[model samples]
Target: MKRIVEFMKRNYKIILVVTALSAILWSFIPREKKEDPEKDKLILELLTMVLERGHYSPVEINDDFSKKVYHKYLENIDPTKRFFIQSDINEFSKYETSLDEMILRKDISFFNLTNSRLLQRMKESRKIYENLLSKPFDYNVKESINIDYDNLPFAKNKSDLVERWRKQLKLSTLSSLTDKQKLEEEKKKENASYEEKSFEVIEKEVRESTLKSLDEYFNFLEKELTRDDWFAIFLNSIVERFDPHTFYFSPEDKEKFDVSMSGTFQGIGARLQKKEAGVEISELISGGPAWRGKELEAGDLILKVGQGKEEPIDIAGMRLDDVVKKIKGPKGTEVRLTVKKVDGTIKVISIIRDEVETEETFAKSSVVEKDGKKYGIIYLPKFYISFENKENRDAFKDVAAEIEKLKAQNIDGLIMDLRDNGGGSLETVVKMVGLFIPEGPVVQVKAPRRNPEILPDPDKRVQYDGPLVVMINNFSASASEIFAAAIQDYKRGIVVGSKHSYGKGTVQNVIDLNQFIRSSSFGDLGALKTTIQKFYRINGGSTQREGVKSDVVFPDRFSYLDMGERDEESALPWDKIEPAKYEPLQINYDNIILNSNKRIATNTTFKLIDENAKWIFERKDEKVISLNLNDFNNELAVADEKLKKFKAISDYKNTYEFKSLPDELALFEKDTVLKQKRERWHEEMQKDIYIEETLNIISDIKLLTKGKSLTQKLSLN
Candidate 1:
């Protein structure tokens, strides 16, 4: 078995593995560190063997690859262009095209030299920043700093490096000046007798804060990290060239990955590790914003975080907990993560924040009444399923129960709010879609080098055949796209939201690397996840890149961004085969849709929505920003003023009213937290323009059907 597995590992190229495996046998041999180069070489050889044989699409390691890896690894380490000067680049340039050769020979000379230089530069830069912050800056100077670094060249000498640090420090103080000015103004507004600190004192405090952040950053570097951590970043940089999703997880990274996956939906969904160089992403939660965005991945280093439209605050050497605090914010808000990719390019990605929900707060439904007609709304956060037991806490079952309760209320319409529900269990999605249509093929799965298999809804019973609207946005992905595409293909419901859902249609399998090596006793080999299958809609069209399109599209905040599966460079391309033989629903609401579009075109909410989308789009693409305080403040004020016109957007109201079902209401009375969550949900739903519009359409459907329930009307067929 061991010999056969070795042969397979040496040649096999399309192995599918899961994210975590418990098949790890006991081995006390401690994992290798870079201190012992021979043992580290063994781990590398094992990893290379696995990648060469198991990755879906592995590239040959040639001089071309070596050059790519060299540049990418270097860029990943020094993304800010501050630490390494032109001469440093020249010295390292020789190895830029020789890195792949070194990998084959298991040479560590390049890493040894670069790591040493980076440490030296870090120490040098620390002294420069401390010295500059030691003295007060003359704020009266009209000097400006260029905020964008994309077009700039590396500093040619030490003096230039010092200038770079000076501008960065000045930018920090400029922000502090604005904040202090605000604090003083607010104090005076609150009370006429209030006293405020002077501008000089505020400037001193701001400089002190910056120095404190620096002190803590240096403390972490000197204490908690090592050279091996930097080398791990280098290894991952090499692997990522295969695809955005492929990565290398150091032993420490694997542990962090397990812990973070346990509470993934709570933050930006990225597991970060502190390293001798900076902070690197250990792994991203499967369905979190980082995974969905495609720009972030394991091995990529987080350079800074910019809140809202503010310039990014450097967190390269900052403490891990403090870095996390800046990333985590209230749901529906935005936090920009400035990350350095394996290739060294720096980009700021904006993610709408969210958090993990408790079981009781995960999924809920409400009833909205319109024109004396009642409609039911079921908001599924994700297609959750418990793996421990067969019948415990399944999302499909909870949704079915909600449907039954809505039917008892004699509801006129039903809406499944799947906005920002990244995706979850495939089985639950298959079962959930079954509730709306008759038993039929739901999704098609295509494994590597195999014919596509049609996964059908095995249950023949239709749970709800009424007026339906399924909501989705850019964040709706994987299984969410599966459900939305099936419903759209069946023409069973009117799909609504952004242009389309996130187009992540490929299925991934992760496996324990140790399972492949037995006698070697080389300790833990971590785990590897590989893409194994492509998912297609029932109509035979792949949802890999071109996700399911909405019937009624709206100008959502993400509409203008490069956020879909198509935007992912490594995403599988869309394709088609013979269409599956399944019948769409026998209902027609083409005119109702046209009526809704007409109303949508003229709606004030959508008008401003379009304008705001434009604003966000323009803001993101701006190539230059002034670092001068007056110029910065003036520019920000203009944007803020424009945003004021849309203040009423969140407060828009209609005559629609929402209420919980009797069972939930009774249950909520006993659980105060549950009650509060439901009340908050109801309040938000009332303010949702999309929900308001949906209620109108559903009410129109009721009028068109002459007050007959949709299920009853469908019975005539």
Candidate 2:
């Protein structure tokens, strides 16, 4: 091993120089600027070759596979059934079997046919929505609309398509009508003269809004969507067939993805997805303006965006990227978003644009006292590391430093918070896991055409040997699962939280398409992230579909929700391998875990969480929502009434006073806003039932271990 290390050290520079020279030489090669339509085919050919050569679990590209890809692409394109008709489907069905030939031949016939048909249908549907909206909708009429469009069939003809638009337009206009009615009621309560507008006038105004949105959508379709634009979508359709995680990013999109992953970006810090009505806020970045403001939520639908006192421009039908462009601007600017809540309430919220520092990405420490015993909680959002800059701070180093700080604080116990930490650097995580265990195999990596390599902790020094616990949830994935699994297998710590962490054990490397194309100038060929490896625990169990099982499970709101790796249709299957050489280091986690489980069973906080989980699942199950204003309002009230019981979950607290490490307080002193944010986090810490429970478990561990050294205690077990 020493000889191998010496050889690697000696040859590293030579290898790097050779790689650099290869890249430099490749760039200098003469290339043609081709305007040929066959460029996409060439890209597809290269992508297929790469997937075949590099993919860990390459799937067959047979006729059956081609059919699945065709269906998947169609589902992705017209998921809501708003555009395509039965005849269009019939026309596209001819290539249902021929897609295999097309994929093999790189033929553009299928894409051209579908693209032309979609464009034609879009043009025709634009007129239909306008013609139907010319007349006022009858709100008094008792009619229901099922928005579960995927389960429903496409329009049979142009008349059928028109009816579809009519129902859709009414649903949207109905929301506006209800909002307007509520406004008038509030105005009346304030004794303000509310000009009574006729229902027809309100309907006309709503229709005009819809028209403006359609015009904007079509304008974007005509101008921005080039022939090359859909190629990325087409490529993505092919790559996703292998697995949901495998993806293609256009050069522009790759930059966006990089910016997003950088932990700080000058944007609203809310992930958006296009829905039927508007751009939905998929998630709010922790410590971002959106999360700090707490006005927007994950499920909130953004209808319009107003920039610095500008008239709110409707974003109901706008593309997600376009909406993102409008929402993201320079720091210190203001962006107002008109959002519709889950309960059908519409309101406009203003957010001051600023650099959203993702505190969750880096390791942060806060002291919490339980039963006269102080414990340090290391909240790790991700296994973050900057590959471009070796000097830039990484999660592993920061986490170790934090542990040192906590050690100086004389923390009786340590709890590593890995909840919602969608994994980052694998090397970082292995180093991080070493912070607890003295030395052992952290994870086993099995790559294509390579032997399984057991990644062990090089450091023999255990940072903290106190009663340790690792907290994880359904969102904890990849590297997060690796650390948790290692701890669990080694019996070095107690793993708590959800039944399992997110089962994303696969590794991906983004290959630049432009770099692969020698002497070819096809503009930007984008990047493809392909899964080339899978991770396994020291115990040999793959954390693929069946993620690392928690030592002590706790109920949460996402417990019943389909939130794990197994929930995804295309997720890789879980398997097992030969267990690595590692001995259990835990003393008596069974007793401690049993006690914790009992507490979780009877704890009021958990009971509230259990009830909340059920309520959430029930909400998710209800696909067909009422269109009637009264019924809709009544159902929302019923849901709220039932959900009221679960409000105590977040309100529940224990005797734990949380404070940031003294080193971090200096930064807060300079930034008043950050100080307030930290204060808010500290306040929330008090109410966190999960952390409180973890501290209780730690206190029990300390009591159980008694006067024995942590190493001696573990060795005895």
Candidate 2 weakest ten by summed lDDT: 1-10
- Best model number under lDDT: 2
lDDT score for residue 561 of model 1: 68
List candidate 1 segments past 4 Å from native: 1-36, 60-68, 104-109, 263-322, 325-357, 519-522, 702-717
TM for every model, in the order presented, reads: 0.82, 0.90
How do the residues 424-502 of candidate 2 rate in per-residue lDDT, one tens digit apiece? 8888888888888778799998876556789899898887787888999877788889989998888777899998987
- Candidate 1 C-alpha error for residue 488, in Å: 0.4
Clash-forming residue pairs, model 2: none
On TM-score, the leading prediction is 2
Which stretches of candidate 2 lie above 4 Å from their native place?
A: 1-32, 190-204, 272-283, 298-323, 333-349, 358-360, 650-655, 712-717
> What lDDT does the true structure give each of the candidates?
0.70, 0.75
TM for candidate 1 is 0.82
